[model samples]
Target: MKCKILPPKVLYHPVLPYKQLTSDNTHKLLFGLCRTCMNKISFKCKHIDDPTLNKHDKIHEIKRCKECKNIKNEKCIHSNEERVIVGTWSTIEIDKAIEKGYKLQKIYELEHFEKTSTDIFKLYVDTFMKYKQEASGCKCDPKYCKPDCENDKECKTKIQYIIDNAAYNLDIDKVKHNSGLRFIAKICLNNLWGHFGMRDNFTQKEYCFTLEHITKIVFNEKYKDISTMILDENIVLTEYKEKEEYSKPNPSVNVYIALFTTAHARLKLYELLDILQERVLYMDTDSCIYNDDGSEACKK
Candidate 1:
C-alpha cells in the first residue's frame, strides 16, 4: 500500500457538543474553564515598611503576578494577603438567591478594634493561619497529634503544644509566636489594607505623599517599640486645614479606602439598577450580563 492522505469533502468534530453555558450552568463553566485571567494585574501594590514611596511608580503598566506560571521574570511583582472582589449577578440569579434564603447586605471593608498602628491585618491572619506554635523551636510535630487523635483533646503532647504556642506574644518577650510566623504577620499587618489605600496601580496604588507621609514622619520620630521596628504611623481624620492643599490627600486611619470604597461603589451601582428585585439570568463577582456571546457560550 502507498502512503496517502486524503482531505474530507466536509469535516467537523463528531463528539457531542458541550452543554450551552447559561445562567443555570455557572458551576459547570467554572469547573470547565481555565481561569488564566486571574493572574493578570488590575491593581497596584504598596509597600508596608516604606512610607517614603514614589508618586511616579503609582500608575505603572499592567503585568501578570508571580502566581501566574506564564509570567516572565516575575521578580518585580508584589503579592498581598487579602483582596476585595466586587461582583454582580443577573436578575434571575437574584431571584434564586431569594429562593435559597439569602438577601444581599451592604458589604463593609473590615474594621478592626486594634489601633491603626497595631497592624491588625497581621494579628488576625497570623492567628487564623495557625502559625503560632510552628516557630517556637519546641520541635513538636503535628503528625504526632492530629486534632482528631484517639487521645482526648487534653493529651499531654497537646498541652505542651498549647504551652509552646503561648510562649511568646508579639507584644511581650516571654510569650512568643513563631519567629517565621511573626515575619509573615509583619508583612500582612503592614501591607494588606495599606495596599488598598495606595494611589498607584503600577504595583500598589497607595495614596502616596498624602497626610500618611506626614504621619509616618511624625510617628517614626515619637514612637518606640522595644521588640519590633515598625514604622508606626497615624491616620488623622481631622480636616486638612493647611493654607495650601496637600500634594496628595491625607490618609484615613490606616485605611485601604480604595479597596472598600470601590466595593461600596459596586454595591451602590447594583442597588441603583434594582438588580436583585428584577428577573436576572446570572451572577458574577463583578459583572452579570443577560447573555454570554463568547464562542463557548455560542456553541451549538
Candidate 2:
C-alpha cells in the first residue's frame, strides 16, 4: 500500500518506529535458539561435498559425523538470499516417548543459542501476554513488536481485561490451551507478516512484475546453489523487463528485517511446541501439525 501525504492535522506517526536487523546476526540467533535441548533428534542426507573444503560452503553440512561437525558453522551464516535448512524436533509425550522409536542424527547442528525478546512470538500465550503488557504500557517498537495495542486506548483496555480474567493464562502458562485471548492472538500471529504488498505508486509494468517475479527472484537466489532439489520448470528470467520509473528506497520496508521477524516467529513456534511435549509432525511458517485430539491442549 502507498502512503498519501495527508494534511498535517490527521494522525501523526500512523506507522510504528522502524528497526533494523542484520541478516547474519539474525541467522545465528534464530538457529542457536532452536538447537537447545532437542530430543528424539535425527538427520539423514545421501551426499556431502566435503566439510573441510570451504568454510561458507554448506554443501557438506553434516551434524552427527564427528569429522563433519567442524564445518556446520556455515549453517548460521546466511546472506540476504541464502536458504537455511532448519531442523526441528518434537518433544513427545510419555506414551510416545517409550515406543522404542529410532531415528538418525545427521543434522547440521546449531552453533549457539541466545535469549529472545518481547517483540517476538513465544507461542500464542506469550504473544497474548506480551500484547497485554504492551496494552498496559510495555515496549512497542519494530525491533520487538508490531501490535498497536499500546497506542490504541480501546484495544488496550479490552486486552488487559482479558488478561486479568482469563483462565487460560493461569493454566500453567501454556498457549496450547484455549482462551479468547489465545484465539485472537493466534489470528494476529498468523497474519502478522503478510506479503510485502505492492505499492500503488508503481507503473503497470512494475506492478505486474512485482507480483509475478519478485518472489521468484528471491526464491531462486536462495535455492539455486542446492542441487538436491529438482527444478522441474525453468523460470523465464527476462519475461518482464520494462524501463522503470525509479523511486527512492523506502527504509521502512526492508526485507532483512522482515526475514528476521519471520525467523524469530519460527523459533517461537518450535519453543512452544517442544515445551508442550506434543508430537510435532510438521511446521510451515505460521502453522504446525501435531498429533492431538483436536482439543484445547492440542492447539498451538
Q: Give the top-scoring candidate (lDDT).
A: 2
Task: Report the C-alpha lDDT of model 1 over 185-213, residue by residue, as the tens digit.
Answer: 55665565566576521211123245665
* TM-score of each candidate structure, all chains considered together: 0.18, 0.25
In terms of lDDT, model 1 sits at 0.36
* Cα RMSD of predicted structure 1: 25.2
State the number of backbone clashes in model 2. Answer: 4
Candidate 2 lDDT, 255-283, residue by residue in tens = 43355565555556656565445466766
The candidate that achieves the highest TM-score relative to the unseen native structure: 2
Clashes per candidate, residues 3 or more apart or on different chains: 31, 4
Computed on alpha carbons, the lDDT of every model, listed in order, comes to: 0.36, 0.37
